[model samples]
Target: MIKTTFSIKDLENLSGIKAHTIRIWEKRYSLFTPERTDSNIRRYDTNALQRILNVSYLNNNGNKISAIAAMDDCQLEAEVKKHAEKGNTTNHSLQEIKLAMVNFDKNLFNRVFNTGLKELGFQGVFREILIPFLIELGHLWHSNTINVAHEHFISHLIKQKLLSHMEHVDYQPDEQHKELYILFLPQNEMHDLGLLFLNYELLSRGRETLYLGTYMTLEALEHFQNKGKKLVYITYITVDPTIKKVPKFLKQFEKNVNKNGNSDLWILGQMVAKMKDLKLNPTHKTFDSIEQLINGLETSKKLEH
Candidate 1:
């Protein structure tokens, strides 16, 4: 069964509106008419959520709450569309992307994504739009606002876009950068979208990278062999490698692949970030975010020059 009703907090989270302000809008502006529960708590339907998002978008774009409240739902949505067409603010684009996901509308998703690319460029779209959208998507998933299918649908679409962009980035191995960056996801870890984008960034910056996508094992690294150049193995552990197993996995990786120190491991994602006591080998490193990892790599490259 689908979750059609949401609490006031969900509305605030999804719309970026304050719960107090939502209450005010309910009492003063009559903007929302959320139904009350048996105990008098408020419950809002999907339409209310969409309307508040639209109102937030319009109000952020200079429309007054009084004026927004006066407009009918059609007018409010029209105003939002008009403003969205004029400019691609991060918030507005995020809302459109969320709606696209909820409705499973490929055309709408493409339209918003393409618009963002045109205005923000690929990196900007990813940093400003897609990243935040994905973060919120996670929240939605945990809140039960969306199911796994929704997550998969949107993830596949984003992956396709990332792959398409990556294909355009042609990089020949630079003699100066002898370090080969190999990106992958650990075994049982299927979330590779972040790693995919990281590969694009690496390739775009002229880093020689081999993307050995999801469900990879440390033993698999042996196949690549040490060709004399340093092999920098990178993986984003969004899931899998449960906290208890991360240390064991790292130790196994050291034993299996990096025993000679010919390779270095760069671990990332929420999993490792939460492991406050994680000890790393002198050659290994941990990054809290993609940006940090990218900056570290770029700095290393410059130092090499």
Candidate 2:
């Protein structure tokens, strides 16, 4: 059996409820019956944590604790589900997901993701919801609304989903077009889900890719360029290669890859869009959105063939 025990801190972090309030609920309404550790510490199980979250959600929306505590399991779950599904423009669903992540609630995250995917297909969920959600989460983290552990939990879950989709795609190289695109993030740039998903999108459309994952060095890339392999280097400029270093980095990249006759560099990201100093060469391009980049690639491919 999976042990569902959680420390007091875990409960607080997960539900956004104070430890004192939780204790009061436990004493006043018999809200949770957490098992005591051998040394007399309170340890909450998964069910208890879930219940507290449900109660907290209701309480936040003006439900009284006395009434919420009287609710049966089925009733509480139904209420939570209703709230989740209701088209409330003011609802902070992403914040709820963040709370779930803080508590390490894999089930909650999966439920939310799957629901969003069902309502809006993978592309829609990715573009409309997940992307915006990630950006907002980053803001929350930087503003001290959430911590690193919470951010990491959600990031890992999203990465797993992206990797699973990537694995399912086919990536056969076309002899007629023996070009291979390699995608990666530079050193200290750990955000790669967008790049990974783009790789999957390209692979699904019968394009070849050599995904280098996160934190690749410039030196390592130089060794991978082969004569027949028309190289296209793609990266998202989220972090590292800062605004100050972008001009130098692009200069070095051009110098390194210009030796290969047929090589191009494409960049997409918030930082890339904001870059004004870097003068892009004929073989270099920057796109504001993934769709724009893909469209450009398709146009380029048609022109080349």
Candidate 3:
């Protein structure tokens, strides 16, 4: 029931197939019949776009386009299934997810994620599929292989899914337990998928959380601290607070939240790992991955009692 119309550029961008070649395929092989707009401009629907992506994947992997076009849909699907079922590494799946992201194909992304999740489980999918996919996306964006719009589209989709999962968690607060973690990004940091998913994980464990979403100023934490409740201020420093600004940010954050003796700062992301002179305060800690951070929390709690 979903209408999936796409401009010619979207097809080209998503499939990595040249527009001219796509036209040739349309004319020569009768691959897809795209609808024409009022001005006679061609637009593709979701099904057509997905076919092109599948064809593109096949072509990229040494299948001849002419041969691919000659095959029936069932045959083509069989071939694609064989390739997909071959236990391709995480990198290959990441590439497919990136393509789906660019095209804004929720179906494709869901299909890919579900497939990977079935094979890898939630934690495995996070580490093997989602994490590497994000890293690759960042590299592509930084190198100008992908535009900012594509990055934003994909990130928003992922964030939405994480938020949906978070909503299903039943939160319970323990006054005696200093376990409620508030997660956010700094004012200039726009990345929230990492932080959002962390919230899902924490909430899944029956811990309480106050997610401030994204682009939050440090001053905002003061309001929460004023509540006189023990809370952990968790943040992902992917951008905005770069390595040079980390010491200053941490110093200021600690000074402000110091009034709440039970408060601590938990930071993660590439920027945190890259920091060399991270002024270590007793109330601050840096983690390389979400798993490490969560494990550390569990270990800390065990040692507390």
Candidate 4:
């Protein structure tokens, strides 16, 4: 279900403004006039949420709270647009993306995305902007600030961007590349935007990749092993294989997919935190962040040369 009302805490999580500061702004500048329930708890609607996000953006970018509060709705929005266009700062783009996700505004998302693409190019946009946005989106999801629909909506848009950009990549893997990168999501794990980005990264680097998308099982991966090339199996774990089952999953994965040690498993996402104490097999590697994964690959390539 779409969220119609949000609490002050939700605003705090979304806007990166403290609830106390929001309360102060409400009383001092009338920045928001939230409704009060019988229990006196503040409730804000979508319009108010949008305002606070814009206000927060301006405030973070050097506009004073008093100056922001004095502006009318049109003036406030114009200021936001002006500041956003000034540099298309990552924070501004991120705030705009968040607003787009919250309001289900496809046009807004596309505008911000296209602007980033023009200015930063695909790699810069993905690594410098979209990755941070996704990370914050994950936190918002966990904090109960956003619902599943918001995630799916934004993910679909980003997946579209990745696919369209992938189609434009002119690079092709050479016969001497000697490694095949296979990306997938574990069974019951449906989040694939990260995997899609990884595929784009591989393709952009002239690496051969087989993208299996989502809901992949260990048995399905076993088929690609021993193909006379070094197989790099990569997976993004968003919510599958409960923390309790991760050890078993890893064991089964090693036994079924990498039993011959001719392949490697590169694991990423939140699940990696759960495997800290678990003894990984020789062929297993975990990346705490996408930057680390990309950098590690480049570093390894340098070492290999």
Candidate 5:
């Protein structure tokens, strides 16, 4: 069996239950005590993580810890599903998916994705489950708790599913008439999954989008220029060209995009968001979230109709 071992800290991170609280639950309520390492450190298994996650979810949702402590395994599971059915299963799904990533278990990953889709639908899964999972994955990767391979395993799986969802959605000919949105990632940035999903979001909302994908330079994007069609350009600045290089990147980007006054520039992602000294091109707008940008487009679409 693939190792599903986790430390108390991992349990704390995954369940949102502090280590001290978990200890109290163990001592006072006998919440499935974990096995001790040779060093006497608590080592939690897959089932323990699942139980604590379930307990954490129920407790957060108004179920008392004492009541949860009194319940049998079946009763606890019933309680978890009872509240989980009311929605907000992303937290529970996160742990399962995390295990799937660590083990590189494709079947388990598919099951988790399918379950999320059934519970929350496509957009809900993306916003509620997938985004939070990515955040956690990033932390694990950063802390060396998980490797880049593990990160890519989960990421590629999500990418495939997102593309599948996009492909399956029916788009009318009139939807094709919507304004062209060109999406890309700036040079040296390979994280294009977010951009790809945003294409789905735009396309689903009746907007025509051309996804140029990763490692695109401003020079390369100029080809989409002067097509006599006013284009809404979108790109992400994610760990590419470095922070100090952003000013220069924007300057070069301005040289190309600024040539066309009618072309609109939209910049997204964390690198761009956190750059305090970065200068935006004269022809650019920044969005805090994809939801904000999509809502803006929806509002504009309504006004035009």
Candidate 6:
């Protein structure tokens, strides 16, 4: 009932299967016969998408397409489930997660996440499974292959997990060699999972952090001015400031920083990556990935010592 019909392009985006390869599979192996629209355009149903996702998962895990094509649906489902429970490795769980998203099965999503959490702990679940899973989900969202419901379903699940982790983090700010980090998003920016997770990471490291999550204006951030020994303003900008508005935000942020407070703005997310040359004199730095940003923080912690 959730409009499960998809085009070949949607299948490609959702499954990471090249259209050409799908065509090849159809011709050579009779993969799944797609129904034709009134105009004879190929349209795939929910079952077809699931099959493609299952096939793609197996194919990515070293199963040959020809071999997969020969297997019956029950056999494929059993094998996929076997891999899903095997270990933290393999694309099986991600494939499962995708299917869960399609079905809007909250229980399935929790099961996959719990398995990773049990095996890897919180950070491990984040780095090993959730982050990579997000990268795939991003591709789906970017390609418009997924709807708002799918995106919101997975994001809120992740958000709940992050919040749960934060509740247990002991907020111990090291007295010596300590910096107060004010984490925020620019005005109109509503994405906060990345920023919240960062706050979690910093808090876990015993760093003092003030998380002003989402939709923070430059004017409001000025209040955190000069809050500690060393001040660092960190933010993940996913939306709100466009490629054009980014430079303007940089200028405004610099002015908004505690005057000569010797603060540095550490920026992350796509806007910075896209606008790599956007500079902030000596007041700002851009990180390409979360790992890079974490490494930078670790190095900063060492230097502060």
Q: At residue 42, what lDDT does model 5 achieve?
A: 88
Worst 10 residues of 3 by lDDT: 171-180
Q: What are the lDDT figures for the candidates, one per model?
A: 0.84, 0.75, 0.76, 0.87, 0.78, 0.82
Lowest-scoring 10 consecutive residues by lDDT in candidate 6?
A: 83-92
Better of 3 and 5 by TM-score: 5
CA displacement after TM-score superposition, residue 203 of candidate 1 (Å): 1.0
Best by TM-score: 6
Predicted candidate 5 versus true structure: per-residue lDDT over 111-188, tens digit per residue: 888988787789988988887787677677666666678778889999999888888877654542445789988777
TM-score of each: 0.87, 0.67, 0.69, 0.91, 0.87, 0.92
lDDT of 1 by residue, 103-191 (tens): 67789899989988888999889988998888788788888777898799899999999989988877766678788888989888887
Query: Candidate 4 overall Cα lDDT vs. reference?
Result: 0.87
Q: Which wins on TM-score, candidate 1 or candidate 4?
A: 4
Candidates by TM-score, descending order = 6, 4, 1, 5, 3, 2
Native-structure RMSD, model 6: 2.0
Better of 4 and 5 by TM-score: 4
The sequence of per-residue lDDT tens digits that candidate 3 reaches over residues 1-305 is 22357777667755668889999999999998899999999988767766787788778777898999987778877877777777754645665686676566778788877787689866577777887678767766775555777787778777766666566656665444656689888888877777877887787666788889788887767878665566788888887777877888887887765565678888888887687465588878888888898887688778977
Instruction: Pick the winner on TM-score between candidates 2 and 4.
Output: 4
**Whole-model lDDT for model 3 versus the true structure?**
0.76
Best candidate (score: lDDT): 4
Q: List the residue pairs that clash in candidate 6.
A: none
Candidate no. 6 TM-score: 0.92
Candidate 4, residues 14-62, lDDT tens digits: the string is: 9999999999999999988889999999999998988888898899989
Predicted structure 2, TM vs. truth: 0.67
Sort all candidates by lDDT, best to worst.
4, 1, 6, 5, 3, 2
- Give the CA lDDT, 0 to 100, for residue 224 in model 4: 82
